[model samples]
Every structure is written in structure tokens, then in C-alpha cells.
Target: MTALGPAASLRDAYGAALVELGERDPGLVVLDADLSGSTRTQLFGQRFPDRFFNVGVMEPTMMSIAAGLSLGGRTVFASTFAVFAAGQAYNFVRQSVCYNRANVKIVATHGGLLVGGDGGTHQMVEDIGLMRGLPGMTVVVPSDAATTRAATFALAERNGPAYVRLTRESLPTVTDGSFRIGRAAELRSGNDLTVVAVGALVARGLELADDLARLGISVRVLDAASVKPFDEAAILKAARETGAILVLEEHSVLTGVGALVAAVTAEGHPVPVRRIGVPDLFGESGDPWALLDRFGMSMQRIRDEAWDLLRLRGRVE
Candidate 1:
């Protein structure tokens, strides 16, 4: 069974959002590092050529130029593959954008292990950890295309440096709730355990929650899209009420949002918290979902972890 009627692309939604945001706001300008085709920023460029700039594979220039445009009172959006945006152009993104307090939005595409068959060279899983560590930087990872659209508009309105990570593969829309930066949504409620998932994993997390329900596990699911100002209160509440928390993400487990969840719970209200994500290994070439299963992000792994955690707490017989 699938999570919804159809799978949609978040990159497409981001490109479409750019067009809409540009129409209403003349101050909106977009920059791309010769990857507009893949990142979908070309759609906005076609609509507003005067407001768009393509830096032709110069990732650092794209970020620095976006910072310059923002300094002129323009709301700038820079797009590229996650590896280039976060890895190649990281120096400029840090010194020119974040440090200078530039209103630049780095809406990176092809993040995490979703870029199937691209291998680790193109796949980027550490963008979240990198962006969230920057001071005054707001990091958002939408679960689906619908939320991507909402997040783009919200980040446009928000000041300071921001990052939005998008996967290459299409994903099912997991929620109909409104999007708010730094807020988390509770999709399924339960007392046995809480499953906090971000990005494409949210859909899978919701799917596993249903199957766990049939086995009387009563799993709760939280869509933790915002990574920086994460909903600590919500996670803390879940930790307190549920007694255990499980975090899922497409990125590596180290320094990812799961650590923040564990930190919040450990400091505010300690609970048995376990995480399911990519190990420290690099991403390999394979089918995205299949690689996810191989990397221990499968539902079977969720069941095993849930059972183990619950058993440790004497909740499961």
C-alpha cells in the first residue's frame, strides 16, 4: 500500500513557488549555479529573466552574488544541488551569507540519499547538520511538495540566512496541515511511542505507524520539518507522555535532527530515545527506497527498534 494518491516532486513545487513569489514581490531575485534545469529554478528564470542570474557552475559565485543581491534589499534565492550548495560553496555561504546576515535563501535540491544512482558524490546528507549549526540560520526540510511550497513563502518572509533541503525523488504528501517554520505537526497520536520523522521519511514513518497500530503498538508520528528551531516543546511533550521516542531522517544519524530531539528530551524530560537513519557510511548507488531499506530505514527496522525500546521499558511482553 502507498501513503497517498500520487507521488509529487518537491523541486517542481519549489520552482513553481518561485514563480508565484516573484509575481507578487518584485524584490524576489533568484540565482542558480548552472543547475537550474535540475533544481527547477529555470522556470522562474524564464518568467523573470531580469531578476534571475545563472552563475554557470560557479557555486561559490552563486552564493556570494545572492548575498550581494540581498544586501541591496532584495530577497534572494540561490539554488543548486545539495553537494555544491553545502559542500562546494560552503565557504561563501558561511562568510558572505550567514556571517554577513544576508537575506539569502539557499533552497538546495538533491539532498540526502534520495538521489538514487548518483552515488555519494552527488548525494548530500550533511547539509542539515551544516546549516543548523550556523548562527541565525533557519533550516527547513519539508516532508512533501505541498509543504515545500508553504515553506518557500514563509522563508521568503523571514529575515536572515535560511536553508531548505529538497530530495530528488518524488514523495507522497503526508499532511494537509499548514506549514510554520520551527513548528512540528503531530500526524498520529499515541501513548506507547512517538516517531519523529523529517523529509521523505515522514511518509514512511506514517506508513509504519499504521502497521504498528495493527500490532497494538499505538505509535505516534511527528512531522519534524523544521530542524533549526525544532519543536522542542512538542518532542519533549511526546517524550513525557509516550515514555519513548524514535527519530527518523534521510540524513546520517550523527549531528542530525535526531540528536536535537534526544538533547531536548534528555535535558527537559529524559526518555528512551532511539534513532533510525543512515549510518556514518557514505551513500551508495541504488534505488532510493531500496537503499533506505538497506541503510536500516525500513519498517522492519522500525518494528525491531520499537520493540527493543519498549521491551527495555517493560512496555512490551
Candidate 2:
């Protein structure tokens, strides 16, 4: 609803939200694979030590335990890096949690190139695709701290398997606290082209819209927070109204929200779509912002792609 004032860490908001949830719901329990400090689950662990389980570095074991706890009538929140939670423990999550439709919330932190100095090994850009592929799993990537807090609470209340991808770097608050899973928020409206963004790229999408506006290009921006069970209505509306779309994300362009948006539009509207994100390659150690720029996730790349797509559609010269 309003422009972002200052950057706030999503992981910080996640920890606070977990503490609040612990206070409100005694049925809630948390498990971490020794990454509670980085993943921000330590706040919950400190406040509700009895309800928290530090399962060492065994991510799969933690996932299995979470599934068991869920079966025992407790809403479980498991924390770990995106790579471990969605990549390493994927099989366990698929069979143990998703198969039984366990009420488990896998809140993964340090997703994408935002891990910065941690390099490619720790920075997970494919977790969204992995989690989204699982049957009966709800995937969410909140853009900022406020939305992260909202998503955390929403996942805690909802039943079944869910993955909330979070970033390590701080992000400006772009949401107004009105967050609903499976629904996208339209930040800017225009008719020339639609820019659909997820996670950390939403703020860049908004800035892209502003810059394009100054250049006489009317671009609409849609925050695709809910990767799984995506906002089909909003996407289709943008395709129909704008006639062209560009999908932006911090993950790989191959299997992230861009791929999903393209598939959805191809089936329903058949509009010209372009995807901007990390390439199908591993990232190296560097400043987070530099990595984003190098991987073509920056506003410049988005602007270039928008212009290219518009030209292809004969909307620009």
C-alpha cells in the first residue's frame, strides 16, 4: 500500500512471529537442524525451550521428527537453510510430511543469492522449484519482513505441508500486512506490460515500474508471493489487460515462478512472457547485491527484458 521506508530482515520477523505464535498456541512446536541461530529459530527456542527440539545437523531426521510430531496432533515448525530443508531433506518431506498431509511448516531461511558471502553451496536458488513440485505442499516466498511475519502466522494456522522461503539479507517492507496464501498483491497498475515478481525481487519490480513510467512505458507490477497455488486470476488478468508479462524472481529462471507463470499463461492467455532470474548455474561468493546484478536479477536487467518483450509484442519501437 505504501512505499518501503527502510530495509528489515525477514529472518528477524520470522523469529519474532514464531515467539508470538508460541505464546498464543501451545499446540505449536519447533524443530531445528542446528541452524536455529542463522535461521532465527533460536528466539522461539529460547522462549519455549520445552517445545523446541535442537536435532543437531540432521535435516532429514528433523523433518521426520516434524512429521511424527504433526501426527501426534502438534502443529510443527521446522527450520533450516533452504538447501537442507528443500534439497537435502526433500525426500523425507515428500514421503513423511506431504504424503500424510502432515501439519508441518518448513520455514527455510537464506534462500537464493541473498546468502551473499556464503557462496553457492549455502545459497539455494532451486528450493522453490523443489518444494513446489511436492504433492500437497504449499509454497510461499514473502517479499519483506511484514509479509514474512504474516506468512509465518498463516502457515502455522493452516493444515498440511508448507514451505516459507526466506532471505538472509534485509529487505525493505513492501507489504501492508494484508497477506493471504495463494493470492498475489498488485502493487502498481498499468496497461502496457505486467511485471510479476516473487520474494526479494518484488521491490525491484516496483522500482522497475517507476523507471519505465518515467520513460513513457506503463508497466503493472504484481507480487507473486504464493508460488504454489499461484494467483491465477491476477496473472490471467494481467495477461489479458497488458498483453505481455515479465516474471522476476531471485531463483533460477528455469523452474521458479517464471516457469510457472509461463505455463499458466500459455494454457490460458498465450501472452508474450520473459523471465529474469539466476541462470542455470551455481553462484559464487560475493556481495549479495553484486551477485544479483551479475545474475541479471537487478532492476537494469528487468528494465532491459521489459523493453525487449514490449518490442517483440510491437508495443515499443
Candidate 3:
């Protein structure tokens, strides 16, 4: 855990990290589907012009080219909006990347409802579920700019197909720049309950834990950055120690990290679990924070859910 800092953009951090990784590894290549500016892959293109490719607006073609590059022993990273990467280029990713287990990193930005005014057409709320279902695909959703920076480097070293989810909005820095795939970081420790959160919701989870602390409710907050190959050991430990769990995410409740957490607990140690996320519906155009609140992912909603879980567990009178 690290001290909270001012808000920073994960996309910017990701772009800078790609430049750093390119400088370190000559085999690393980048591809963008006409969204380099918005997805921040332009930074890497500027630094490594020869190693970067702009594949026009064809996301599926970009994915296929990345897969071919990976098969040629080059570490390929492709960037696009989540909607385009996961929705438009899904078949290419499945047949070329995941099926072949190519070393391609699909770093999609503007995930979830945080695309702000992009409306339902551009916002990708189902990306996590889509990517996680792919076999041999590593799913990572870093909580902040620092963690995103670390995850960018980690994915470069990892030899497999991976999907790194990033947000369009700025988020508070939470982790201390150390991130590993398939590992969860415990931001705060307590015994009453455990709140598992990811991406932008991590900062909100920390706020809820702090607020609950004043009311004598101790909450252990776990940042579940890696959605697939989830940290089951940490989750089971929390279940045994706290006996209650609440999962928070900026994506849909169905097939999100919350559902994975529930599956983990059910197999090992059954406990009361409450999940707070967007219900089964599309997101509309609005302020990013307003959209989050409207979708019931606000800090206030998380706090209320915490209280409800506590009551159900007989921890609150």
C-alpha cells in the first residue's frame, strides 16, 4: 500500500510505460487502429517510429497483424478503445491471438462507463467478461496510474496473450508501483469484512473503508487487479478471517470480478458476498462520475452495500 496521491490518467501512464518498454526491448512493437491519440499509443509511436504501426481504423486487422508479429517472435502490443478492441476485433483476437497463444498485449483504454459522453455505443462495460472467457488470455485491470505503469512492464515480460484494461478518466494513485499479474494487493487490513475492488472503484473502496472505520466497522480492502487467474489465496484468507465480502467494480455485475470472487468462496469457504456494479444495461452519455453514480457504483452505494452485508452477517445491529 502507498499514500494516496492526486488524480492521474492511466492512459498517459500506459503510453509512457510503452515508451520505456520499447527502449528496453528492441523486439517490442506497437500497433494502433486510428485511435493512437485517444488511446495514448501516439507517445510510443513518436519514440519508436519504425517499431510502431498505424493500421488505420481497422481494429480487427490491427489485431491480426499484432498476432502475426507475435508469431514472428516479436512482442506486439495493440491499442484501441475497449469497444473496438473487445467488440469489433473479438473474432481476430480469439482465432489469432488466444488460439495460437501469441505474445500480443491488447491494451484497451476507455473501458467501462467512464468513457463519459461516449454513450452506450462507445463505452465498453462487457470487456472484462469478454476477455476473461478467452482461453490462455490474461486479464488485468490496474487500479491507478502507478499500477498501470507497472502492469505495462509486467505484461511485456509475461509471454502470453494478455488484455490490459485502462480508463479514460483520471484516478487517484493507490499502489506503490509494484504490480504482478495474478496477484492481489491488500490496501487496508481489518477483520469485520473484506471489500474487493478493481480499477477506478479501488479508490472508492478505500474511501468507504475509511468512512466505515469511524463507525467502528473495520474493513479490509483488497485491490483485485487481475480479474482472470484471480488471487484466490488472498480471497480465501479474507473470507476465513473476516467472514464477509463485498466486491466493487466499474463494469457489469454479471461475469465481473465480483462473480469470480463469489465462485472462489463458494468452492472453498462459503460466506455472505455482496456485489456492487452496473446492472444488466447499457450506459448513456453523461459526466463520468455521474454515470458511475447513476449505475450504483458510487462510494455512497458501496457504503450502503457494506452496511447491508454487515447486517446480513449479524455484524451490525
Query: Which candidate number would show the highest lDDT if scored against the true structure?
Result: 3
Each candidate structure's TM-score, on Cα atoms with residue i matched to residue i, is 0.97, 0.97, 0.98
Give every collision pair in model 3. none
lDDT of 2 by residue, 187-270 (tens): 888999999998888998888888878878888899889888899999999999999999989999889999999999999999
The candidate, 2 or 3, that scores higher on lDDT is 3
RMSD of each: 1.4, 1.2, 1.2
| lDDT by residue for model 3 (140-184), tens | 999999999999988898899999999999999988877878889
Model 3 misplaced regions, further than 4 Å: 1-3
Local error of candidate 3 at residue 298 (angstroms):
2.0
Candidate 1, residue 106: the lDDT equals 97
C-alpha lDDT (0 to 100) for residue 311 of candidate 3: 90
Better of 1 and 3 by TM-score: 3
